[model samples]
Target: MNLFERLSGVIKEELTSLVNQSIRQEDTPEEEIERTISQMRSKVMATRIAIVRSSASQARLLKKGLVILEEELAQAEAKREALLRRISQANQRLERATRPTQTPFYKLEEKALELEAIAQAADELNWTKKINS
Candidate 1:
């Protein structure tokens, strides 16, 4: 065989060997695609879990706030009732203070005493008998 022909053949054989080795070293496209899909699914699951946890926390906070508001409402109702009772007491006092005397005999007695005292204070006036008459 000629030296040039042998050399060419050897170089061609080396090129074929290198291509096969590269193919063997690299993963198939299908395997790479599956690995990426699996990683994305895991990330999605984690995100879903985080959202659920956040929602639960918010619900708990709202429940606490509602309880606090209800307690405040109860306190306000109690205060209103107390104020109403105090107002009723004050109204009763005002009514008692402003009401007129009901007995005619007591009214006459009071008037007679007032006139007697005034006539006594003024020596020249004789108004007690007039008031009694």
Candidate 2:
């Protein structure tokens, strides 16, 4: 596998780990949360770098980018869950912890859920079109 593909796998694993870590904790350390968010930020950097590296339409290059993106999506799926967990955890911990009362990206969470719904609808539409054709 190429650099992008490897990076993508790393990012996905990191994200998955972050989700697992966050979920397993009765109380998470600030440092761990920061590390998780930092890794995600790095994943964004890796994605942008991969996109910039999009120079040719060679099968390998194309595949490399796609794998990275797939990893990113998997990571995002984990993130979506983890974010919800964070929000829930924050709410539960609100009276005791110094953390904020709500998750920072409530609107973003809603939007992501909306996008997933749209994607599912599009898939159904495409399947219907194929059957009709």
Per-model tally of clashing residue pairs:
0, 0
- How well is each residue in 66-126 modelled by candidate 1, as lDDT tens digits? 4554565556556656766888999999999899766998799989999998877775454
Flag clash pairs in model 2: none
Prediction 1 global C-alpha lDDT: 0.59
Candidate 1 residue runs with Cα over 4 Å from true position = 1-54, 106-133
Instruction: Estimate the TM-score for candidate 2.
Output: 0.29
Candidate 2 residue-wise lDDT at 64: 68
Which 10 successive residues of model 1 have the least lDDT summed? 42-51
Candidate 2, residues 8-85, lDDT tens digits: the string is: 787688878768876874655545655655665666566566556655554456566667766776686587678879
Q: How many clashes does the backbone of model 2 have? A: 0
For all candidates in order, the CA lDDT equals 0.59, 0.69
Model 2 Cα shift for residue 59 (angstroms): 11
